[model samples]
Each structure stands twice: as structure tokens, then as C-alpha cells.
Target: MADAVFDEETNVLLSQVDIEPVDANWFDIETDFVLSQFNLDNVLDMDVKSGNFPYSQTIGDLNVEANKTETGNCSSKRFNFEAKSSDVKKLQASSTPLNTQKNTRWDVNTWDDWGKWRNDRTISAGLKESAPYVLVPPLTVDIGAAELCHWMCRFILEVRRQDGSEYPAESLRQLCISIWRYLRDTCRRYDLNFFDRSKPDFADLRECLDARMKELNVSINKVKKQAKPINRTEEDILWSSVFSLNDAACLQYAVYLYACKLFGLRAADEHADLSVTQFTFGRDDVGQFIRYIGGRSKTVQGGIFHKKVLAKDIKQYANDSNPRCVVNLFQKYLSLVPEDGPFYRRPLATKTADGDQNTQHRRLVSIPYRSSCRECAKGQVLTASRLDTLVK
Candidate 1:
């Protein structure tokens, strides 16, 4: 049911065939079913398809290439979420843009790269020159490029493996990397990329993303689709009125509200999309349900993090009697959570741009869905709820 489609209107990837909405988290069918139909299992652990890169070259003793002719999906200017790419014709990872002080995602591929271009030895000159006040003491929120670079480098290498396996060590790094990647993009739009770009080679990788962007730009659906996400304009919890009706839709919204207000978590990767394990209780601190925590984050780049789902609302919605298939990976066993898993998830956001609607559009509705799913509060629908409504 899921075939490749070329949509001339949006220049976004589409399917020759229509795919039914099995769920927001994953494909409706099992991976085995898909693999059987496409014979993909036979291709694993093998060489990838061949291709020609027109922009191949050498830079600073490293072989380089661009994704010049590769096809783009949701990363075009339309959405702006970036993917860790292996394409060559896109852009030079080291090609620092004019007027921009930091490097692109493609430029740095090793710890040595961090030492030189990223100013790993100390704080970034860029931060000191611009906002000196922000750098005077123990940097709290606004950070410099150097420290961020070092942190990101360390985190990435912690989980990065030559074997290309998503083992325990690697998964943690990926989760952190994924979280930081979305945060980086958010900061960029909010004028914070200088301190927020912690994604693996975001600066360098982004440099080589231009071609892919262009290609993807030519494949999306022009104009927002009707089914796009419907994000709100303010942090409105007015939906609490559903106290008496704890039905599926109401409970879903309540859980969404808790995610936005409580954890401020918003991610679209596998960890968030799937339902978390749950258990029932009585008059307990966790109330009725408890979410499964200790899962990995998608942007971990590297490093292990064990997060506890220490929230009240989340406990009520754990996968149990009223389970809505919501995933709660951070419940317990933080040590078991992978680094490359989704930190928070829901439906994909409506658009990549700063829009009120976060989940109205369906298919690749802007890269926000790829990055941060629509937040259920604080720019989500506003509603009032009786505390008992969430009790069960």
C-alpha cells in the first residue's frame, strides 16, 4: 500500500499508491510484511545502490562529495528539518556561509574537526563578541559554540560505532542527538542556533543539504493540505472541560496537554510514537497508570541517560484499561532506554514554520512532523479540565 509517488505540486515525496492511516507512530503493517513484498531482507548487510556525484572533491585531506542529483523528501525549504545524509552533491559540509560565523553540518566529521573549527579548547569567540553579558558567568541557558561543539562531539562519539549497530551504547547517543537536533532547529527560528545547534554535524551536514533541499522542494504538495495538523496559537488547556467524558479523543487530548505543559516534550521518532508499557494502581502517587521511561532518545549522538516519567497526568494515561496506544518510554528502567529513540512523540506537527496548527496536515505536513510533533499545549487548543476528569 506504500509506493513511491512523485508529487509535482509540493515537490515532496509521495506514493504511487495511497497508504491508509494505520497509526501515527509506524506503518500500519509489520516490517516483515513490507520486506516480504519488496524483498528488502535480501539486501541488508550489502552494498547500496550505485550513483554518480557531480560535486566530488577533496577538502582538508578528506574526500568530499555532494548530493547534487539526489531526491529530497521533507527537508526542502518548505519544512527545514535536516537528515544525517551520506549524499555528496548537496553542499560542502565546511562551506561556512557568508555573514555566518559557525560551520555547517558537513564540515566536521571527527573529534579533530571539533578541536580546530569548533574552538574546542575554550568558549566560542562568537559568543564573547556578540552578547558579552550572557557569557560572564557559569553559562546557564545561552551557551557558546565551542562548548556546545565539544559536548555534541563527546556525546556523538560515545555512541557512534564503526559496526553501524544500534546497540546500548549507540542508542543513547542517538536519542540525545535527536533531541538536540529538534531543539537546534527550534532555536534557529527563534534566533538561537548559535547556542542551540548540537545535532551531529548540523552545521556541516546542513552545508551539504542544499541540493537535497532543492530536490525535495520540487516534490512536496503545494499549499498546506487540508489534513495538516491543527496547532493552537497559545498555551491553552481549555480542553479540561472534558472531565465527564474521558473517551478516547478526550483522553488523547488530555495526554497531549500533559506532554506539552509537563515535559515540554515534542518528538516524532519511534520512541515517542509507540505506546509505553503501563500498570494500574490505587490512590497512588502515579494515580492509575504509569508511563514506561528509561528509553533512549533519538539525538543521543552518544551517552546514556535514564529519565523517569515523574508526572501525574502521564501516569493516568499509561497503556492500560484506557490505553490509547500512547507510548511512555520514560517510565522506569532509565538505564534501558536507548539513546536513539524518540524523546517525546504524538502526531507530527502541522508545518515546519511557526504556525498555530501543529497536526492538521497529514503526510509530511512540513518537517515539524519529522522534528517536533504538534505541541498539545502552549499554542495548542485551550480548555479547562476538572482534575477528576484526568483521574479516570
Candidate 2:
């Protein structure tokens, strides 16, 4: 009513107040047709003026603006605008963040864009690298159920690790299950019919896959039983020479071994999660107890693991000629480490002369706190490869 009153007083139409003059040459009819397909009628409200059309839409303060440029043909002008509509919002909501840390869905977008070719290319690439292709391709929608069963069997035989060992049967079964889940989820997103429960098409494929998985589970259990823990003799040898070692790498590794045993941390978990700030000391009746919160890993049941050790337990391992004392070693390691940083660090080169024992001892004992240890502090945590080498 107010707009009509004002327009009548000014002798102008209310609709003409904010509307832009349209020129048909400035409008792209094909683009308008595409927008109309999604029922977004109000998105680009173009009006015809002098056989020309200019797009305009206004809702409250929101308005669509288009930049027009005349084509060489002169009969048409290209219209470009920032597209923001309800369909775009729906798409943004559907796209979830992938689990890149685990590398499980690292190639999800690439695989989706390339469709079945991504799976085939992955298999070919894995074959060339001699690594097990854990990503099992789902039975193509166009293939028969019998063909899927045949493909599954062939896939199982073809998959092998970089070390030339076949994937454990349990892992193969898991891969199949994971692939099926991925296919079903993706199909649901696109509103496609993936499988019919009432039909017998998938029955044979399911039966054969389950049977293979059962056989593989039994073999997996046997392999798990045969697996052994780290040798105790090797642990002793590692700690025994740690005191005589002045090398930064050796010291860093010694700290790692003791920390692993003290906290029962997995190699990957400790390397990634263990930092200088994770340690704290408390007093008890026995003596001081050192506690640490270990980082999370795949095998770790809880997201975080808390472990504590009595200072005396590590003190027993200490000797005049040996730095096997976990507490002392941790303290020395802490002196060189940054607060809230990685507890284990890669070493820098030694500045002391190779033949100068006194100088090396002085350098080790006189390491300045809060000052950068020259050629001996790389600030990196111990890695799996480094851990393996330290063990050997």
C-alpha cells in the first residue's frame, strides 16, 4: 500500500522503481533455460525491453547482478554473474570432508569423476608398483551377478603387497565389504537404485563372497598366532651401548625405546603424538613418578592412552657407564626439547672432534638449556623407519 501510494504520488509504477532496463542482446536464453530446469524462476528475472533483455532479481536486499560484454557477432552479448542458489546449497551440504589422514578416501573425488576407470587405473597402478590394491571395485551396474562373483575371485588372486606377499584373506574380505558400502552410499546420494532385495541377482554374489571371507578369517587367526613380539636381547643391547653413544641419533632413539616400554606406545602413535609437553612429574611414597599421555593410533582402542612410571623403576636401569635410566634420559631429552613439542627429536651433527672424548663428554653434559643445540637438534620426532633401524 505504501509503495503504491508513493508511486501514485510520483506518477511512476511500483514495479519500475528498482527494475533495470532490459536489453535482449544482453541476456543468454540458453543459460536461462538451464536455470529454469531447477525451478529457480526468481533467480534471474529478466524483462524484455526494446527487443533486448537484462536479467534482474531482488528479494529484500539480495539482488543478482550480471556483467554483459558484446560478442563480435553484435547480435548477442555474454552475461556472466555469480551463481548462488538453493541447489548449490544442497550440493555443498552433501559434500562431506574425506578422511585424508587415513588415506582411505584420498582418491574419492578422482574416483567419482572417472567412474569405473578410476578403479581399473588403480588396479593397474598397484600391479605396476607391486603393492596390494586394497580398494576393491564394486560390480559394475551393467554386469550380471555371475560376472561379479567371477571378478571378485580374480581380484582376490591379483592383489599382492609390494613385498610380493598376497593380502591376508581377512584384509581381502574387509576390502570387499568396504567397496560394497562405498557403492551403496554413493548410489543413495545420486538417488540411483543399486540393488533389489526381492531379486535373486545379488544372492549368488553374496553367498560366494561370504564363503571366501570365512575361509580367509580362519587363515588370519593362524597368522596372528604365529606373530612374535620384539626380542628382549635386542632391547638390552640397544640400551647397553646408549651411555657410550654421544651421537644425537642414538640418544634420540634411546629416549624413544624407553618411552615406548614405559608407556606401551605404538610406534606410529608415539612418533606422531608424543611431545615435550606430554610429560609431567609427581611425587609419591616410592619417589617421583613420570606420566605421559600417548597419542592415538589405529590399533589403540581409546582415542588417548595415559601411562605412568615410578622414577625408581627407571633408576634401576641406570648405571655409571649406562644412560639406561629412563627418568634421567627423559630429563636430558626434555632439556633439549621445546615445551609442548615432540618428545623424541631427530639429531643434528656433533660439533666435537671424533677423537676428542673429553670434548664430546663436555659437550653432552654442558648442553645449554633454552639455547639451540648446534648441529644436534632437527626438531623432528622419531619415525617408523628410524625406529626399525634403531631396533636392528
Give the local distance difference test score of model 1: 0.35
For every candidate, C-alpha RMSD to the true structure in Å: 29.0, 18.8
Highest lDDT scorer: 2
RMSD of 2: 18.8
Instruction: For residues 1-392, write the lDDT of model 2, one tens digit per residue.
Output: 55665664577656656656789978677665554367433433433333333423243223322222234324344444456797786664334322322333423332243345546776777654454443444434543444555555555445554476656666666555544544455433222222345546555555665676676666654445321234555455445644334556565666655555555554453455455666776666666556675444444333223233221122222234544556666666565545555454545554434431121212232212113312222332333333343332
| Residue-wise C-alpha lDDT for candidate 1, range 45-111, written one tens digit per residue | 1323222322233232132223432324334645675545644323432232221212222222332
Per-prediction backbone clash count? 102, 8
Where is model 2 more than 4 Å wrong at Cα?
1-168, 184-202, 213-228, 242-247, 299-323, 350-392
- lDDT measured at residue 356 in model 2 versus the true structure, 0 to 100: 16
Predicted candidate 1: what Cα RMSD to the true structure?
A: 29.0
